[model samples]
Target chain A: AQTVTQSQPEMSVQEAETVTLSCTYDTSESDYYLFWYKQPPSRQMILVIRQEAYKQQNATENRFSVNFQKAAKSFSLKISDSQLGDAAMYFCAYMEGGTSYGKLTFGQGTILTVHP
Target chain B: EPEVTQTPSHQVTQMGQEVILRCVPISNHLYFYWYRQILGQKVEFLVSFYNNEISEKSEIFDDQFSVERPDGSNFTLKIRSTKLEDSAMYFCASRAFFGANVLTFGAGSRLTVL
Candidate 1:
């Protein structure tokens, strides 16, 4: 079974600054997908960005980006120019490749606090 | 972009009662799923539905739980007997057949079994 681990349970960042949330995974499958999801206090989960294992370039969505190291089994999310709206419970997820049913394995989550 | 929508944002039911959580997945998406989050725990996958059938299910989806897509737009999850342990936020998600495996999720429905 594949498992995703988010070591940082809580993180804080000042407005307009940058912060990184760390994530790691255990999977034997050579091909897979990684994603970062943001759940606000309202409890709506929103997709932040995604990275494909086969791609060497990291994924970026505006101020959100990922540092994906496949060989190291690490996928970390970077939030630049952080705004108060970026505050949320962030989750790292993993999914198997090739004919996947879209079932996701999620991490414990990291609570990000962005200070103004 | 289209979004998945769920009904009864919050449900309070007594134990042993049957409760059905409903969802309307994105119209064109082919894959649908149900996941739950127990209070402070990580979100867990319960079941996945595709082509009007269950593609896969987790151990947590016991016989007490079942899913249905009665109409073209409505996908429902029915729990035969609710327990206090079943109190959690139930989320419905869907994804298109061709994408980066991106699953669009609905605002979860909080089910509280008393």
Candidate 2:
């Protein structure tokens, strides 16, 4: 019933530069959660950051942050001071709130390449 | 930090054969989930288990698929008959409880069906 879309299939950035990955979703639920996950070459899905729909303030975790626009149903991730290790497949995921199970709907991941 | 562990990093099997993937969720976690991703595709939810029973499942989890917590620490996903299309990386995830939203995921088991 819910769908997440990552318009960009691939992205590249130079080391120490900043990059933003765009994500949008179609959902009818009012309360939900959003997350950004990074899968490096090792194929381990690591949580980058998270944001709650109820909170307008964006979430920031060290070098990873999110621009969450609840009304627009858009949540984008920003990586600052990108390192080569940041190169990975980035995924935007969504989950409904209010007594619902943590079933995640993920977007078509964007492959990020950070140059040294 | 506590992490979810999955076995058989990679497995190759023939069509119509049975395959079982195993995972060990975090000890303190109460919720467990199985998700899969075909090569170059987004991750898709397969099933969620809680209290030793499946709480929810997706359309992708058909009769051929089954999940079990045979012991206190291990959760397993069994495919009765593997198909070529079933080839994918299967991930096991767990969360602390109902109010905890973040689901920690394992490295995933890559299954190749020939």
Look at candidate 2 and give me any clashing residue pairs: none
What shift in Å separates residue A107 of candidate 2 from its native position after superposition?
0.2
Q: What range of 10 consecutive residues in model 2 chain A has the weakest lDDT sum?
A: A94-103
Looking at model 2, residue A14 earns an lDDT score of: 97
lDDT of 2: 0.95
TM-score of 2: 0.98
Off by over 4 Å in 2: none
Task: Report the lDDT tens digits of candidate 2 across residue range A17-90.
Answer: 99999999999999899999999888889999999899989999999989998889999999999999899999
The C-alpha stretches of model 1 lying farther than 4 A from their native spots are B98-100
DockQ of candidate 1, scored on C-alphas against the true complex (2 decimals) = 0.85
Question: For candidate 1, lDDT tens digit of each residue in A1-116?
Answer: 88899999999999999999999999999889999999999989999999999999999999999999999999999999999999999999999985564889999999999999
Question: Superposing every Cα of model 2 onto the true structure, what RMSD results?
Answer: 0.8
Every model's DockQ: 0.85, 0.87
What would the TM-scores of all predictions be? 0.98, 0.98
